[model samples]
Target chain A: LKALNGDRRRWDIAKLIYMNNISPNDCIKRWKGEDVDEDHESEIEEEEEDFFQKRNGTASNEKDAHEGDLETFKPYFETLDRLMQKWKKTDLLKDRFIGKPAFSNEDDA
Target chain B: MAPLVFQGSENFRLRLILATLAGKPIRIENIRSNALDPGLKDYHVSFLRLLEAVTNGSKMEISYTGTTVIYTPGIIIGGSHSHKCPNSKPVGYFVEPLLYLAPFSKKKFSIVFKGITASHNDAGIEAIKWGMMPIMEKFGVRECALHTLKRGSPPNGGGEVHLIVDTLLAQPITIHELERPKIMAIKGVSYSTRVSPSMVNRTIDGARKVLRNIGCEVDITADVWRGENSGNSPGWGITLVSQGQRGWCTFSEVIGDAGEVPEEIGMKAAYSLLEEISNSAVLGRPQLPLAIVFMVIGKEDIGRLRISRAQIDERFIQLLRDIKTVFGIEAFLKDVDDPDSDDFIVTIKGVGFTNTSKKIA
Candidate 1:
């Protein structure tokens, strides 16, 4: 598998899964006994950090805010991740969206 | 057991120096210390070996941990700064998203061991450059090669693309697209929920408190409003201070100056300040734009959409007029309809000639 994919863009799905943005507790609730998609998996990665920050009540930087701020910042991150996955899948599909950059184009992807 | 590796310590330093001197290219792969999963063990080593083999014949520095790498072109040079001074160019280079740098020439990239500090985290590469830019200018060297050993990790958590896109555009867009301000004013709702006069007073108080916490004068009246349906009428409407198209404009002056403010340690004062304000806004709508400016001074239920800078300027002028008229101030309304001077800051006094200070708070 390592040889199959070139060294250029090797993606560790598990690392992505562990580094997911969703929280484990949330995962326990929403994803319990269910197959998690790549997007939800990424969200869970950030959930642990969020849980700790909640327990501790303080972290040095805003980045330590567990996940992106629940209100404003998180949406952008989630949206970006969604777009990236959409892009990856789109790249795999038969017809490609033209006139847009490789990484952009979130509509109908 | 292997010697306790104090990263950037003498032993590690010696190996890098000898390797660079021996004409070997260096590679530092993903730097992680947390307990790793057995599943990722093979791929991580494979990532490092590829870098090791690629630079085997060249003189370069490679710093490798479990999953992070930093490969520089040329010998593992140190002692000197990488910053470029006024009279000189830059010597060191760093790029984000850990993309592989493919050189077009045979020029061997040099390496300098700037001890690792979680350079593997997202946004690490880009944020590091903000600190490095000023330092690099001091070194008086220009242009160096950079190749990441890891696969993906952007300096801004992959925000580089958006950053670049923003740079090309002459003007910033509404907060709607840029930062996603919660909608305070619905298109037809008589009053915006996000920021109403009631909400405005409270949120501004909140934002003021936030500013005070970070230390800054929370002066400056924030006028929020919706434009008139037809002819010019007083548009005193409440809007979320951090929402809609106008919110970004109110803060742009502040956000733009963030690079100028200094701090004892870490990034510039302005970056942190904007980050705080943005983060706070995300938590809830706190700031409101002062109404009574955009001629709809008395209208109700305007939709919240993105506004341009020009539109903001035009509206501010209208606001100033109403402020003068309603308060009976000394400044003459500089043609409230003046296509030329909106916010009619008397070109002469640079103040609203009819300045009437009020205690809205």
Candidate 2:
């Protein structure tokens, strides 16, 4: 716990706490010393920068980094949504276009 | 068969594996086109070589700058072979696709792979052993084995693993329903090579601290390798698998770093396993690609699966497009309506592909 508290500035440690069931309030109380508001906020700010840089490879600021990450994945989400819409439309049209033959050649023969 | 063309180097493994299975040629262009050091890397070349080793009559053409490659796939003639993987990537990167292709090979496939066994990026060998093999069995392919002969770490790798699989011509599988199985126990392997033997114990102790409250029996074994079994590098890592009923297992792992403590690795791995278990998905993250492959090529009927959105990435979307283009199998994904639900139900009907030619049957 001491080690984690000492290295609480690291982004991975923050991630670890976030992933586990520990609440942010408890984490702040245990890891960050009381009455050190500036230090605690700075540490979180630095961790956010590190997280964004690691996530999308470019991070000028936290907001820009987050937007960039979203931009990187926006095309994929759009493509998936478009594909799903097309498939749904195709399913609606399948019965009319792909129904059984009205007159079988064997019956005609 | 007409050649399938695509841009970019993403989904390279999936494209090649599907091409081999479909008996079609593929032309990939603009590989890393915008990157500073664009084109195929040494690791990509090594993967291509491994593919060539498993197939017969395969032909490849590469541009001088390595920006373009045209691959004509050949018959999958599976037999004993070996390849040295590049140090840049872990063996898991290559092993995952091999798991998809091995069962359909013409002969009983046995391959010895040498490279990094565990790393931060790719799925570790232990994950595949516990998580993927059982899923493959559900698809009716049996007698698959992955054995670690030497433990290796990243940067300078010398690990060795032996893989064996029995081929099947055509096997139809039906999995209409997936029930969330109750986790019976949690098992793990904490290993170190050329490192302090106490590292294993530290990892196990740290993992147990987090895992004991999960209401399941937990057992983690430790192994310290030396001499021939230990690779050149000095490193340690932990692989944790949560075993559930109905052949369901979730895997998580963490590789040690220069300044990281064993306890951190163990705790991180345990938390990752817990996250996976809590995520309401039928297929584990690593098993998502394999399940999609089976759904595309299995018997012609509706196949349904509910997977977490975390498993759906750009590579998975590209794979769906490729399957649609090559095999004419359409896949649909619909998000569940629950506000707290993170599941996407995917449905697809297979193309009923069957292999008619067998070298020995």
Candidate 3:
């Protein structure tokens, strides 16, 4: 499905739904659920150190910092997946006012 | 590297300021494409030129029809330079962006600006001086000041302003816990240029009538500029700012339009300021952009703020998206559970960015 329309001016319905469903707490919770072993723990610590050190012009390595950002953003993608499933079950685009206005008698007068 | 992309021309100033601060390239498409003129206007071009003046080696690419813009920003080298702001917009339009960029520049910054100082559409210069400068001071910008050398009105602007900022990187400051401080005093400035000096007195009288009923201690000063200090156009306006003990301030202003009486303008401005003061939120609408910028660049702790519901509009949602794109920070908005409250607490964990480009002493 197209995320943006042909003119690329407006976001498609799917994109809008995807954006509206994001939950930050849900994202953080999903990140905490990931399994962590000793090796991964050490890697996380190193990445954390590099994150601060890079800003101070001390760290030369860029690959680990890139991976750290991706790791931090992973849970947000999971939350998006959950939202898409929930949005599909609800008919958001359905027209609720299907017939004439309720005050039609006044208009006819 | 892939550049960040955005749609439409809404909030272009915020986008450009964020792009420069984050050291990222950006591309904006469909700039006024659906409008009658269908391209960048003079003010937009003027803003781009201002951006070019403050930075070194910046590259900008505009489409043939000016519908698309690609900006590659350079390091901020803030020094003394002057620019003629497009007369269509107020000088505040240009000054607001400088407030975001000045502190982190490579050198102590000073700029002399020439344009309209006050208008109905934007915040007046007095509001920026009294209301905004104090807020910036809370964020650890020590040597920032805005001086209005002359008063200018719209449509044939010749006002002059001098802005100065010390060359220093902003230290991360926490504004997480906000308490509704006691209103110390309601202060204001009623200014008139190229008009009868009596207009200033009338404006003060009218504003005092409304503010007196509020039961707050109101002290409003009248400024009547004459001779060379007055600009090419004739105008009168009032700026009302409420100062709080906790370093919070809210401002409201009204500029005189054609056939509008001075007292009417004064009453309108006073009522607007009263409405802002009545709100329970800690910050005002004008201060939201500055708060968001600080949140994105501050130290890596959750920065929290309580803002009124009216501040949470489409522009704010766009700001959230821009923050995420440029700085990789996610802003979370949650409603205050009190049924009678009309405020929301916004929280963001900063990206822990430091100004690494500043030359070491």
Candidate 4:
């Protein structure tokens, strides 16, 4: 705690409070000898635990990794779908004039 | 056998036909030093007259020596079957090493050549006319004339005279053979939605899929722009192809670092892409004419104004000219200028494997 106070960085401070489920101000007040409820820390920990569980259901580490993969690919697929949808209209017109594609060989210079 | 008549000296005509079949006009690499001046004029007149008759469009050529004047018509649009001379003497030789057509077939074309020996009775002013014998037989105009000019004195003397008259009896050449996939006979259409560089590849992919769905064989390379620096990155370009035909359509959005280029500027780039393809075929190399749209959502007030001006610039006119010069392609542009449009459409018509051709080494 003393090391954290000495560092005094915004993101690091937020990380310490949020990860530990404690209010930095309350910690500071207690450090300065102000009276604080012992139950308040326990409540904060419960809130943090509830927040994490709600956000990421109870899944094994491997399952979590697979879910991460799905989450990552979702945006890519969305972009591709959007692109395809955008092209659909013009593609219809292209079909009207260009007609069916004919067989062509791979040899090209 | 129908007799064919050649109206002029034969040697000159043979050279001309040989040159044309070789895909180039005959070059007078080096005239034999001892060759007489009289012979030159005779060759020139005969060559010019035959060309005039064949082309049906007239041309006039004056030799440096005041003694020679040659006239010719322009190039004929189709092949013909006609003869210059039928039968005369054996002063000159006509060699048909591989006459593909049988002698008696309707396709049979006969050539009669005559050579003139100054003193020999067997060879008087040789002339040969190549023609379709059956056609000549129908008209009964078989015999040809070989004019041998007598030798004269200096100021006019010391030059041997040779005149060549060639006639070809050819039928109109039909476009019978399939266009042998000359210079990228491939064809397809690509539709694009955005002006962003990534959309360029997207458009190509869209095009390829459409082609594939329609049963076209497609060969696609890996996405050109790959990895973290992919989207919104500057200077992205790709080569997309359905077949041998290649296209390079790229657009870059310069963000914070360079700031947003005015919308008109983006439009200018898009318009230039069209111009390049349209003019490419005329300048050389076949290009698939395309309809392209520059889609942009305006960020700043200035960007919109800039884009509006670019949409109707002289560059567009030049682009149209290039398209016309190729297989008559016209590109229609669509944009926000006319709203209620789902997407901007650049409609392309008659864009296929058309090209400006030149012989390559």
Q: Of the candidates numbered 1 and 3, which has the greater lDDT value?
A: 3
Weakest ten-residue segment in model 2 chain B by summed lDDT: B309-318
DockQ for every model comes to 0.01, 0.02, 0.01, 0.02
Candidate 3, position B176, lDDT: 80
Docking class of 1: incorrect
Candidate 1: global Cα-lDDT?
0.24
Q: After the best TM-score superposition of candidate 2, give how far the Cα of residue B11 lies from its true spot, in angstroms.
A: 0.9
Indicate the docking level reached by candidate 4: incorrect
Per-residue lDDT tens digits for candidate 4, residues A68-92, read: 2210110111122333444333322
DockQ of model 2, rounded to 2 decimals: 0.02
Per-residue CA lDDT of model 1 for B1-361, tens digit only, reads 1111122211122223222322333443333434453122442333233334323333233334434334342421122122111111011112221111211112223332121211211122222232222112222112332322211111111111111100111111111122333322111111111123443343334334322322212342433333221112221111112222322222211110112211111111122223323333212111111111211111222212222222222112322332332323222212223332222111111112110111121
Candidate 4 chain B has its poorest 10 consecutive residues by lDDT at B293-302
Ranked by lDDT, the better of candidates 1 and 2 is: 2
Q: DockQ winner between 3 and 4, please give it.
A: 4
* Candidates in descending TM-score order: 3, 2, 1, 4
From the highest lDDT down, the ranking of the candidates is: 2, 3, 4, 1
| Model 1 lDDT tens row, A5-88 | 222323322222232243323332232222323344465745754565466633333433423221111111122233233333
- Predicted model with the maximum DockQ: 4
For candidate 3, write residues B1-361 as lDDT tens digits: 6789977786788889899988899999998899899988898899999999999878999999998999999988889999888888888888877888888888878999999998765657887788777777777786888889988987787899998988477445766844445566678999988989889889889788765534346789999988888899999899888877667787887788768788877777776665555443676666777878887798888888877655553345556767777887777766565555555677878877677558762
Clashes of each: 79, 0, 0, 42
TM-score of each: 0.21, 0.75, 0.76, 0.18
In TM-score terms, candidate 4 sits at: 0.18
